[model samples]
Target: MITQQRKLVTELPGPISKSLAQRRVAAVSSAVSGGSDIYVAGAEGAILLDVDGNQIIDFGSGIGVTSVGHSDPRVVAAVTEQAASFGHTCFMVNPYENYIELCEKIAEVTPGDFDKRSVLLNSGAEAVENAVKIARAYTGRQAVVVFDHAYHGRTNLTMAMTAKVSPYKDGFGPFAPEIYRVGMAYPYRWPTGPENCAEEAFADFVGQVHIQVGEQHVAAVVLEPIQGEGGFIVPAPGFLAKLVEWCHANGVVFIADEVQSGFCRTGAWFAVEHEGIVPDLITTAKALGGGLPIAAVTGRAEIMNAPVPGGLGGTFGGNPLSCAAALAAIETMEAEDLPGKARRIGEVLSARLTALATQFPQIGEVRGRGAMMAIEIIVPDGSKAPDAALTKAVVAACIRRGVAMLSCGSFGNVIRMLPPLVSDISLIEDAMDVLAEAFAEVLG
Candidate 1:
């Protein structure tokens, strides 16, 4: 087993990793990018073992996919057992108990006391696409509403829904039509102020939907309960609830894209719980299948069943192995109380990040729930301009020092930390130590 501690045997992107990078440049497309140059050989808990025999502490959690930690024993056992039995019978062709059981579990755990139904998919983009399909089918409407800085997925339709242009949307033109963009209640960057952001943004959002899209033609209003890639930006209080109420009143199916903030990453089964809002449709992925690939759209049975049979499914929508892993992962989350664990992790992270903010004015803000947290980097010149270069420098420095981190946000100025829920507090502290050193070195 790999030790859950940082160990530097060689410089990052050491000889072996450098050689692999050369090979990768020859074999792989230049379009594909990665967060680090270090090639990973193995991972366990919150530590990744690079090909050069270095143990780097993980702060990104594979962009929040390994909430249960890498290769969790329970998930591994379940997948192994299921794979040995049968790999892919195609749940659509020959139904299996695991698929049915996993859906049952999803219905049980996802928010809502109503009779819920779920359709499993292969990725978060697929789930969002299906959610829109179901909502349109149910409401007989066409327009879909999304917010600024939202990241639905990478598919064509999802690209239309996403806010960023340079990486996700550039040159991917002629996107799906009838996708309306709205302003989010981003408290930190709100012009008026955080105190007035909720009400004002809500009004602007509703006004835009009413005037631009016509509420009657809206099929669904999709949003991340807490925007993830958008700098982990938590909207002002009452913002989400107000939107939910408006969607309900306007006959729009509210879809909560909990793809990044779902499972135990946000201290709740879903981040919408924090706002006490139960959406009509919720899309989930990332941490859902442990480290395996599985996504789901679980919601009101009436809405979910609106799509005719054979309308919503794919060849590998709910693979048997993925279902087994999801079941075991959910079981582990319940058994280990990962949600509570996430809250504790949040306390530690919030304290440390707040301290860092006090020390470095370049840290414009630190925000997020549970284990999902981030620090926005900015110029200390009082203009609050995004400092993407500084952010990149800090993250690269940390990675070089045996701590893996990731930078996100519209401006690419947010250092997002998503450590595994099972990571030790001491491990987190050590990683924070590295982060502080990097910040000091870069800012000085």
Candidate 2:
């Protein structure tokens, strides 16, 4: 008989973890992305074990980088076996089956009735860059449009694509030119609310584009299905569908940045599927590789064929080990019905967080799809004002209680939740209870 994994012991960053963190500070670059110094020695389904014999519940899933549980046996075995056979042949020089098989799987999964093709890359940034390149080549346009509060990637072109300041774009300057920004469908901050709010705001954004640069020069209009690092802002109803319609009418290629929203994170393989709209190009990364690093750009065959033979590819893109891991991960999601799992997870969490919002006025908003969730914290009143201080306090409280969480938002006022889809429901309940207790302690 199998037993449920439990997170035990206390003392937040155990002693050994604390020591290792100190060592990490000296050896690792300061530019790494992480909140604190929690050193994880081992992990399983939703549980993290520290070097000091302490266990903690993880809610971030390595920043949504791991959709499957930590160290999934199938993924581990496949990657290990593949690495032992042939680690790196560089697909550009020597072709491989794993890459082609993974691409076929992507074509089969990505939403669309058209003949779709996919290109593999090493990271989300590369996928975004490739998507933009393909769009320009196909449309013969020089401009791309992205929305405000959108989180694409961290590379130079993607840096320009992202809509936040501070940590992401503070010192990085002279970003890729010709990238335009428009208003995003943020219901919480949309003063009038999500009514005709979408129609009015989007129309205004369209007007701005036409007046500034004209639609004739645009290539693609890209937006995250659900803003990941931008407060998990799910667009209002009809917003995405309407955007696709407008793009089609104006001859602009429609692109969905699903780097964080695809692969069952949102109760669906791709969040855009929820609207039944087919994007010309869709980018996926985080969860695509199970736990390994792999990204892809899946789209219409004609558009994808725009780039010439030598136009796209990287040295390590679609590495054999990573491709094998992706194929195994895709199989796992299908066999386990993880998309259904995401739906169940969302129902349970939304119910819990909605109830907590009544008691805690700081929870200004709680919105997301499936497991890709977030809780926005504001001051006592539901004003546009940010309560980042309170947000930080709640996070500290959770860390103190042996639960690992990650925070994100335009103003750093949101507590994001992207727990592994394969995590135990009991573990999820445990984490939620701990989170409620943290809110209690911090707010009181």
Which prediction has the highest lDDT against the true structure? Answer: 1
Candidate 2 to truth, TM = 0.97
Residues 356-405, candidate 2: write the lDDT tens digits. 89988889888998998889998875465889998898988888777888
Per-residue lDDT for 374-439 in model 1, tens only?
A: 999999897889999999999999999999999999999999999999999999999889999998
Name the lDDT of candidate 1. Answer: 0.93
For model 1, what is the alpha-carbon lDDT of residue 225?
A: 89
**Residue pairs with clashing backbones, model 1:** none
As a whole number from 0 to 100, the lDDT of residue 219 in candidate 1 is: 95
> Residue 281 deviation, candidate 2, in Å?
0.4
On the 0 to 100 scale, the lDDT of residue 296 in model 2 is: 96
- How high is the CA lDDT of each candidate model? 0.93, 0.87
Residue 325 lDDT, candidate 1, scale 0-100 = 96
Give lDDT: candidate 1, residue 373: 94
Runs off by more than 4 Å, candidate 2: 1-6
Please report, as a residue range, the 10-residue window in candidate 2 with the lowest summed lDDT. 1-10
